[model samples]
Structure formats: structure tokens, C-alpha cells
Target: MNANELTIAEARDALAGGELSAVDLTMACLTAIDAGTPLNAFVHATPEIALDQARAADARRGADAGALNGIPLGIKDLFCTKGVASQAASNILKGFKPEYESTVTSKLFEAGAVMLGKLNMDEFAMGSSNETSCYGDAVNPWKVDDRRLTPGGSSGGSAAAVAADLCLGATGTDTGGSIRQPAAFTGIVGIKPTYGRVSRWGIVAFASSLDQAGPMTKSVRDAAILLGAMAGHDPKDSTSADIPVPDFEAALTGDIRGKKIGIPREYRMDGMPAEIEALWARGREMLADAGAEIVDISLPHTKYALPAYYVIAPAEASSNLARYDGVRYGHRARLGQGDGIVDMYEKTRAEGFGKEVQRRVMIGTYVLSAGFYDAYYNRARKVRALIKRDFDEAFAAGVDAILTPATPSSAFGLGEMAEADPVAMYLNDVFTVTVNLAGLPGISVPVGLDAKGLPLGLQLIGRPWDEAGLLNHAHVLERAAGFVEKPRKWW
Candidate 1:
């Protein structure tokens, strides 16, 4: 059997049943990563580390084996893996390795998962398309009419690598739809656990409050399996919730019966594609058929979520990214003759940040500036509060979960909007950002195919800290949709 083709759960079963060895599985994935370089999914390949971990996992085979024993997975560059390059796909962090492992990654390793490598992402986790990566765009394995497509942004590499079978699953950090959007584009499952459910202790910060690390996998069951290992309260992250991590995999009972799933009217925006609307209607029908009650709800403040997200995320990013200004660590600029520290700081940041990241930092600085703080940043926070309140009200009204289309449409060609307005790219996160804003758990499950044969996903937003239920509902959706088509190996 092709080891790389096995899903995480399957690999675990195989390893436990002595049908496969972890070393063989890791080597198969490494070979696939080497062969699939055209997809540009993994920026840094860690063969030595992967093989070492796999051998150790093999040694732990019997009653000592853990839940994730012998599983091979990908880690997004955002996580600070000890001794591994943890740059957030930015030149700013060139060759920098962390001294400590991130809380999430360390936990995964303890559970016996091996890391394939660091996946590509939008530099500093900015932008909607993966075009902004300093390593260049991660080409989607899916195509339309022979034209290459984007795998979606920030976590594009994570989604692409998993979908292409380069790895069983991958870690993805979501700061306003990064995980779910790319999962939608790549036809996989990506979940953004409620804020604090997954500790953000060592993941590179984009927007402190919004940034969350989650799992992107080939199936809902795989996502649940990985999330079980990745989610936990860490004392290192003050915001980490002091809650017990549930057995997310065991929660997949396929029983969302009598659940009140809300269909928000605001998501039915003007000019929404007929395909998305149709897909959402099908989702409602699937849930209802499974005994879930579909209810129409209103999130009145939804319209302001995008603008508010832009302002608040950037504001937090500006503060979090200030550490990269040529002082303590990361890249430092070559000083000109007799150059002052101010000049060094300016030159370093100008050279370090990409165009998109720079634009956000400036916008963030501007909004946080004295005169505009109240007018822009403060108001955006208020709007964000209202958005959260909207979700809170819905949940309080007995809404068990909310359903919507994950993206406006299916994957588009890479560079399709490079010449167009940047806002056009930001609009791709329209249906996703609200979940982050409200700090709710959200999952994207591939539900159907578009006319062009690309995957389309439906999202389920759950109550805060209700990831088990969210995954249960997503599992139901996944089984009902039966979306098992893999991208043809064009890369």
C-alpha cells in the first residue's frame, strides 16, 4: 500500500495493527514531498527529524503507543519548532530557529506524531491568496481548464500539502479564515478551534486575539484526531483556557439529531454566486435530513465584520511584530556608514516586511495613532464586540450551530487578481472572518464540486468551546456529502 495515501486515522490503525511501520510511512511522505516540489507546499523539508521521530514512534509500538502513534504530519512555519526554521514564510526570520518547541507542536510530538516539514503560508499570515509568500505562491493541485489555481491563503501550503497526500495532516494557524479558506479551496477539512482552545504560546503572532492554530486534514475524522492532540491549555499562553481537552475523535458519533443549526440571512449577500447559494441550501437539507432543525437567524452586525477585522487584526499585528525591528533577533539590516539606530530600524523593517505586511503595519500604526485611535481602532473594537454579541445572542436563542458557504466560490487561478484591487482578495474571507471575530469554533468540510470540478466547502460555526459538537456536525456533513474526489496529479 502507498503509505503517503493513508489518512491519519488509517495510518494509526495500520501502525497499531502492525500493517505498517512509522519509518516507511515517513519515508513515503518525504519522497512525495520531494517529488511534489512543484506544488511548493513545504518550504523547509526536515527528513532527518522526521525519520528520527518515526523510528522512535516505531519503537513505542505495543501497549505504550499513544493515540497519534506513528502518524506523520506537516507543521506550518508559524509554529516555533525547536531547532527547525520557524519563519512565518517571511525573509524577516531568515535562518532563525527557536530554542523551545511551541506548546501545540510539543504536545503533538509527545503524542507520537512526526513532522514532515514547515509548510508555506502568506508572509506573516497576511493576504487571502497564497501569492504574498516570500517563497512564492503554493500552486493548488486542482486546476480548471488546465490553468493552475491558488490553494487559498495563509494556510494554503497546509491545505495543499494535505490534499495532495504529501502528508496525512498539517497544522494551520487561522487569523481570520486562514485555515478554513484554504481548506475550502483544497477540498479538505480545516478547523479553527475557539480562541484559547489551542494555545498560541509559540505560533508566530499575526493578530494576537484572532490567531489560532488548528488542524487541516484529508477528512473530518482526521481533523478530529489531530485536534485532540493539538488542543490543550498551556500555562505559557495566558489566554489559553484552563479547560480539559476532550477526545475530539471519539465525539464523532454522527449524531447531530435535534440540533438547532442556524442559517444566517446576512451570509446571503448580494451577488453571491448561484453555486454557493445552492451549496448552502443543500447543506441545510442534509442537516435537516439527519434530524437537525434548520432555523433562519440574523447577525445584524455581520456587514461590519470585514472592516472591523482589518482594523483590529492589523492593530494587533503592528504591536506583535514590533519585535522584528532589528533589535533582539530575526533579520537585521546592514548599517550604512555612521547610520543612527533610527535609520537601522527603518531600513530593517523596510527590507524585512513584504508589501502586504507592510501595508497592514502602517494601517495598524495609523489607526492606533493618537488622533485616530478612537476614530478607527477603538470603533473597530466596538464593532467587533457587537459582532460577538450577535453570535452570543444567536447561541443564547438555542442555536446549536450556524451553517454557511465557506467561500464565495471555488478555487481561482493563481495571480487571477494580482492586477486587480487588493480588496477583491480580502473579500474572499467574507464568510469566514466573523467566526474569528466572535471567537467561535468553525470547520470547513468539502461538500460538493463546482461546475469547473473544483471543491466547494460548507462551514459550520459552533458555540465557544464546543469544538467536539462542531466536529460531530462536520463529520455528519462530510459523510452526507461523500466528497471523496482527489485532485488529479497534474503537479
Candidate 2:
């Protein structure tokens, strides 16, 4: 198997056993990236820096070092890497490079991981398809036929790279299904650490309350291994929780016996693809066969979740993105002839943000404005409370986790959904947004491929700080599903 096909644990074992060196694995990914460049999954790559890191990891391995000693990683551009352009796939921040590294990036470096390069993502992590990226959309590396597919968004490039074996694992951020949706599209495992469980410092905020950085890899155990290295509290991020980090890598038992999984009735919407429904049934049956009990549960506020997320996330985005004004930082558009100071600011912002970003900022401003605050923003907040309450109730009733389809369908053509009504694209995230709205941890695991052969995925969401439980269940599902071991043509 290719080094990129190996899970993080598998790679670690091989690296420690002297079977593979970080440089060997890094070069393999570089070769894959070169071959897959037609897919445009990565926005930037630093061969020299990557080689240096590989040399460092090899040095550590020779000295008998850490758990993640020779893993090569892809960092989503959303995470700030000191001296690397940390643009969030947006031209607005085109030449910007942070002097400080994101907590996750620094932690992984401490664990002896090699940084391949920054991956592409939605501009400011906004869209459902990577189409919003100024760097260009990442093509889904799956075949829904002989067509271009969207490797879902925000984290799409990260997912696409991992799926194509361009990298062993990649970092991704999820505000509303960003990580898992792309993982589903590209056939990989993506886990969002429980909100606050991972530090947000230098991650480039989207929705401050919901945005989280996690790993996208080949399996649940690999996800766990990567997550363990990246998660921890930091003094820089006050919101980061001080909870004890668990032995996530050691929790991969491949056994979820005596677990109670809940199927939320509200998630089975009318527009769900029949294959998706069948896959859900299959996932549940597989779990039941493993000595688990499946129960139908109600999250009555599910209908309100997407709406709430749209409102709340945009509201926070508006406040966060306001920092990008041309005043002191970011892209500064040229002022029109005879334009005044106000016009300079206007022109700068006009040129900086794309249409969707501008539209969301307008919507955010409108909703937070005096006239619409109570009607839109405040109502969404109240609904958000009920959604969290629903999950709390389900967990209280002995449901270890909630299961749902990661996405309503498998990967679609790159422009298929983008050209149709924009709402069609928004609806794609309907199944996964609720977890973000409720501030719960969730994971997407590759279950099987659809009739068209594009990969489909199953999502498992857990109560706050229940990531270990969620991953344990997913590890079992992953072993049972056994979809890896083969490669498909990139769409």
C-alpha cells in the first residue's frame, strides 16, 4: 500500500519500525500531489520546508521519539503557519503570512509531524463547495461517473488531498459540516473535536462559537491519532477548555458492543436520496449486528437548526470579517478617481470579498440591525438553545450517540449544483449543520460507495466532550465497512 493509504497509526508503526522514513512518505505525497494537480486540491506547497521537516522527523525517529514521529500532513490554509501564506483561500488576504503558528500546527510540529503545504478551502470557510475559493475549487477524487465531482466544501481541498493520497492526513475546520461533508464526498474520516476541546487561536475565525479544527484521514483510528496531537488547551485562546486530553489513539478498540445509537427522525427528510437512506439502514444494521441497539429519537428542533446556523454563523462572521477592512490590514482596493475616504473603504471592501461573502455580510448586518434583531438574530439564538436541549435529552435517555447521513448524496459534479439555484447547494448541508448549531462533536466515516461508485458516508454525533465515544463507534463501523484497500479514478 502507498504511504498515504496507510492510516496515521499504521504509518506511525511503520516509521517507528524503520520500514518507512518521513522523507520517503513525504516524497510519495509530493508525487501524488504532482499527479493530482489537475484536481487543484492544494493551493500551495513548500517542497524545501517539507523536506526539512521530514529530516527533523527522521532525526527524532532515530532517537526513539513520540507517537506521531514521522507522519506527513497537509494543513488547511485556514490554519496560520508561521512564514507561510495563511490565506483562507481568499484573495482578500492574498499575500498575508502570519508570524505565529496556530496552536494545532505548533502542537503537530512538537509531535514530529511534517508539514507538506497549505491546502485550499472555501473563502473564509463559508461555502458548501470549494467553488468559493479564490484559489479554485478542489475536484472530488471520486467517480459519480466520468464527470467532475465536488469534494464537498470548506474542507474540500483537505478531503480531496487525503482521498487522492496526496497527503496522509489533513487539517480541516468545521463550522457547519465543513470537515465531515467533504470527508463524505471524498471517502475519508473527518472528526470535529468537541467545541472548545481544541484551541481556536490562529485558526482564522469563521463562526467563533462553532468553528473547530480537526483531522481528515483514512480511518477512525488515524483520525484519533491526529486529533490527539492537535488538541490541547492554550493560554492564547481563552475559550479553549482546560479538560484533560484522553488517549484517543488507544481508544480505537474496533468494538462498539453494548452501545445505544439513536436515529433522529427529523434527519430523514423527503429529499434524501434513496441510496442514502439504504446506507443509513445498512449502517444501523451493522451496528446492531455488533451487539448494539438502535432507537428512533426526536430532535424536534432539527428543522430550526440550519436556519439558526445560517443566522448565527453569519452574524459572527460579519463581526469577525469586519477586521478585514482596508484600514490597517488585508487587501486594500485602489480608490476611484476623486473618491473620498469613505469611498476608499467602500472600494477596498468591494474588491476584497466575493459576492457570497458580501451577501452574507449584508444579511448578517441586516439581521443584527435594530429593526431585525429580534425577528431574525434573536429568534435564531433561542432556537439554538432548543437544539442543544434536544441533544442533551437524547443523551440523557441512554443514547450514546446520534447517527445520520453525512451528506444527502454522494459527490456531485463540480458545477452541477453550483450552477443550479444556490439554495440547492445550501440544502446539501441540511443533514450536518445541526451538530454545529448544537456545539456538539461529530465525525464522518466512509461507509460505502453509492450505485454510481462515489463514496457515501455515515455521521456520528456525540454530546459535548464525547468525541472518544463517537470515535470508538466509528472505528468499529470503519472496520466493518472496509471500503479502503482500493482506489478509484478521480472525477
Candidate 3:
């Protein structure tokens, strides 16, 4: 296998054994990035920074090297990377570079990981498809005939890069279903830890309460390794959890015997594809075979999750994004001769934000408006509380983890839903939005391929801060499924 194709765990072993040099591994990844141009997974390439870090890692190789020493990773564009572009795939922040690194990136660097570049994402993480990106859609390396499919979003580029071996792993942020959905679509492992498990200090905001950063990787083991280096309490972020981060890699015992896995009957939505249903059934059998007891559970509010998420996510996004007015930094529109501050603000936003972003902003503004706030935003918040309560009840009833399909369907072709009703695209997160609403840890494990030969995944939702247990459950499912299929290198 090529050096760039190594998983984080495999690369770490090779680097420690002196069989692989950090410089050589980085060059291999850089070469892959150059060849992966057609996929547009990387919006910004930082080869100089990557090489410098790799060289430093080589100089400091020792028994005490960090877990990620010499590992190469792709940073999501939403992260502030000191001198690298951190636009969050939006035109408003075009050419903008942060003077400091995000807490997540800083932790990774401290653990000796090297940055490949900023990966593309949905503009402000407001869309489910990567086409909303100003850099164009990050195509899935997996294609059917001549049609290109979406890698999923807002962490689409992270999913694509990791799946296609463009990087050992990548950082991804999940608000609704960004990380898990893309991981499912691209047939990789992506985990969104509990809402506050990872710091949001230097990440560009989408929905403050819902957004959480996690790792996208080739396998469940790789996810655990990368997440170990990325997760820790941070004083820089007010919402960051003060709890200790456990040894995630040590938790993968592969013994899930006697664990209780809940299968929510509410997840069986009407009009769902037969293939997705079959995949879910197979996932249940796999876990049962591994000695996990499958029990039927009820989350009655599941039907309302999508509406509540659309409302709450946009509401928070509107408030968080208010800082991007043409004032402080980033893109500012050139005003006409007699134009005032208000004109510049309006013009700048209109010109900078893409259609999808503008649409969400408007929806958010409407929901939060004085006349409708109580009817929409407040109502949505109430529903969100109920959704959380549903999960709490399930856990309180002794459920170890909840299992559900990661997405409603496998990846659809690019532009397939662009002209359709926007609500159609939002439906993609039906199974996932509930996890974010509950502020719990969740992971997507590839379980099987659809009739079309596209990959499908099963989601395992765990109790708050129980990523270790959740990962183990997913590891069991991964082992049982043995999903070793990779996207044919059409790009």
C-alpha cells in the first residue's frame, strides 16, 4: 500500500518503527492532494506549513512522541489555522486568515499532527450538500457511470479526502448531520462527540449549541486515535466541557457482549427506501450476533425533529453570523458615492453570501422576528427540549446505546435535488438531527452497500460523554459488517 493510504494507527506504528519518515509521508499526501484537484476536497493547500511540521516531528522522534506524531490531516475550512485561510467555504471571509489557531487545531499540532490544508465545506455549514460551497461541490470519489455524487456536507471535503486516501484523516464539524452523513455517504468512520466534548474556540460558528467537531477517518480505530488527539477541555470556549477526556483508543475492547442497543421504531419513516430498511435490519442482526440485546424503543418526537432542527439551527446561525457584517474584518462591499454604512452592510452580505446561506439567514431572521418569535423560535425550542427528554428517558431506562440508519438514502447524484424544494434536501438529516438536539455522542459505521453498490451506514448514539462506549459498539458493528469496499478512483 502507498504511504498516503495508511490509517492514523498504521502510520503511527510505521513512524515509531522507523519504517516511514514524516517527510516522505507528507510528500505522499501532498502528491495525492495535487492529483485530487478534480474532487476539490481541499480549498487551500498549505504544503510549506505541513513540511515544516513534518521536519520538526522527524527531529523530535522518540518514545515520548505524541499519539499523532508525524500524522498528516486535513483541517476543515471552518477552523482558524493561524496564517491559513479559514473561510468556512463562504465568500464573505474570502482571503481572510486568522492570527491564531483554533483550540482543536492547536491540540492536534501539540500532539504532532501535520496539516495538509483547509478542506471545503458548505458555506457557513448551512447546507446538507457541498454544492453550497463557493469553491464548487467537493465531489465524491465514488461515482456511478458518468454521474458524480455528493460526498455530503458540511464536512463533505473531509469525508472525500479521508475516503479517497488524500489524507490519513481529517477534522469535521457536525451541526445537524454533517460529519456522520458524509462519513456514511463516503464509507468512512465519522464521530461527533458530545456537544461540549470538543472545544469550539477557534471554529467558525454555525449553530452554537449544536455544532461539535470530530474526526473523519478510514476505520473505527482511526477515528478513536484522531479523536484522542483532538479532544480535551478548553478554557477558551465557554461551552467546552470541564470533564476529563478518557483514553478512547483503550476503550475499543471489541467486546460488546450484554450491551443493550435500542432500535427506535420511530426511525422507520414512511416512504423510506427498501434498501435502507434492509440495511437497518442487517445492522440489528449484526449487533445481536455480537451479543448485544436489540430492544424496541419509542422516541415519539422523532417526527418533529427535522422541523425543530431547521428552526433552531437557523435561529442560532442568524445570531452567531450577525458578527459578519461588513464592519470588523473580511469582505466589505465598496459603497457608492453617497452610500452610508447601512448600504455597505446590505450590499456586502448580498454579494458575499450564496443563495442557500441567504435563504437560511432569511428564514432565521423571520423565525426570530418580534412578531413570530414565540410562534416559531420559542415553539421550536420547546420541541427541542422534548426531543432531548426522549433520549434521556431511553437512557434512563437502561439503554446502552441507540441504533439508527445514518441517512435516509445513499448519496444521490450532484444537482439531483438542487432544483427541487429546499425541504427535500433538508429531509436528508431526518435520522441525525435528533442526536444533535440531544447533545449526545454519535458515530456512523459503514454496514453495507445499497442495490446500486453505494455504501450505507448505521448510526450509534451514546449517552453524553460516552464516546468510548459508543465507539466500541460501532467497532463491533464494523467488524461484523466487514465493509471493505472503496470508491473506484474515478477522479
Residue pairs with backbone overlap in model 2 = none
Q: TM-score for model 1?
A: 0.99
lDDT per residue (tens digit) for residues 285-352 in model 1: 99999999999999999999999999999999999899998887789999989999999999999988
TM-score of each: 0.99, 0.97, 0.99
Model 2 CA deviation exceeding 4 Å by range:
62-64, 485-487
The residue-by-residue lDDT of candidate 3 on 33-54, one tens digit each, is 9999999999999999999999
Candidate 3: lDDT of 192? 96
Worst 10 residues of 3 by lDDT: 139-148
Which ten contiguous residues of candidate 1 have the minimum total lDDT? 414-423
Tens digits of per-residue lDDT for model 2, 1-491: 77767778788888888998899988988888888887788788978888998988888776667667778899999999999999898878878989899999999988888888999888999888899898888887776456778889989999989888888899999999999999998889999888888999999998898998899998888888889998888889988998988998787776777889999999989878899999999999988988888999999999988888889988998999988878775688887689887887788878888877887888888889998999999999999999999999999999998889999888888788776787788887898888888888999999998887778899999878978888999988887788763447543
lDDT of 1 at 38: 95
Q: Could you tally the backbone clashes for each prediction?
A: 0, 0, 0
Task: Give the winner by TM-score: 2 or 3.
Answer: 3
